[model samples]
Every structure is written in structure tokens, then in C-alpha cells.
Target: MTKIADFRAMTPDQLSDELLKLKKEQFNLRFQAATGQLEKTHRVGEVRKDIARLQTLLRTKQPAA
Candidate 1:
């Protein structure tokens, strides 16, 4: 789980990379659940929150139009 401060400290590029990685994990987790192979049920919520945190951090770093 990524702390909000950790996400805030990362550069936008780094945040993007992490976001992509988390999204991949999220996909895999969903697939596992569908196949009845999921181990850690709580991880889904953790990843979801982490993805949202990264996105929120990235958005805050962007320049306004």
C-alpha cells in the first residue's frame, strides 16, 4: 500500500508508472477473483485506493488549462 505522502513525493512520471503497474495488478486481481483463485481479498480495495491516490496526486501536479 502506498502512503499518500509517498505518492505526493513522487514526480508525475513516476506516478504514471506506478499507476500503470497498479492497474495491471488490479486487472489480475479481478481475473483471479473471477477464477476463484484470489488469495488476499483485501488487496483489491488496497489497490483501488492506491490507484485513486496516484491519480489524485498526478492531477494535483498538472498545470491548469
Candidate 2:
């Protein structure tokens, strides 16, 4: 789990990598939920939030047009 401050400290590339990982996790979690094999159902929401956080931070770090 990464805090907002932690995301702030990461480089754009690192943030993107983390985002990709989270998305993959989110996909797997969704599959597990569909198959009734998910133990921590709450984890799906957490991963979603983390994905959003990383995307927000990455967008903020980008140069304006």
C-alpha cells in the first residue's frame, strides 16, 4: 500500500510501473470475486484507490501543454 506522500516521492516511471501492477492486481481480484474465491473482498476497493492515487500524482507531475 502506498500513501499519497509516497506516490509524491516516486518518479513518473516508477508511478507508472506501480499503476500497471495495481491494475493487474485489480483484474485478478475481480476474477477471484467472480469465482467466489476472494477472501479479502475489501482488497479490491483498496487496489482501486491506489490506482487512482498513482494516476492523479502522475498527472500532476506532467508538464502543461
Candidate 3:
């Protein structure tokens, strides 16, 4: 799980990379759940929140229009 400060410390490129990784993880988790193979179901919520946090940070980092 990434802390908010960690997200803040990242370059935009790194944040994007992490986001992609998390999204892939999220997909796998869902696949596992659909197959009735999911363990640590808590991970789903954690990933969802992390994705939200990362996206929020990304939005803030965007250049002004």
C-alpha cells in the first residue's frame, strides 16, 4: 500500500507506472474472485482506495489549463 506522502514524492511518470501496476493487480483480483479463488479479499478495497488516492494526486499534479 502506498502512503499519500509517497505518492506526493513521486514524479508523474512514476505515479503513472504505479497506477498501471495497481490496475493490473485489481484486474487479477477480480478475475480470482470470479473464479472463486480469491484470498485476502480485503485487497480489493485496498487497491480501490489506492487507485483513488493515486488518481486524486495525479489530478492535483496536472498542469493548469
TM-score of each: 0.96, 0.95, 0.96
Local distance difference test, each candidate: 0.94, 0.92, 0.95
Predict model 3's lDDT versus the native: 0.95
- Please, what are the lDDT tens digits per residue for candidate 1 over residues 1-65? 87898888889999999999999999999999999999999999999999999988888899998
Off-target runs (Cα >4 Å) in candidate 3 are none
> Could you give the C-alpha RMSD of every candidate to the true structure, in order shown?
0.5, 0.7, 0.6
Clashing pairs in 3: none
Ordering by lDDT: 3, 1, 2
For residues 7-45, write the lDDT of model 3, one tens digit per residue: 899999999999999999999999999999998999999
Clash pairs for candidate 1: none
Give the range where candidate 3 is weakest over 10 consecutive residues by summed lDDT: 1-10
User: After superposing candidate 1, which stretches have Cα over 4 Å from the reference?
Assistant: none
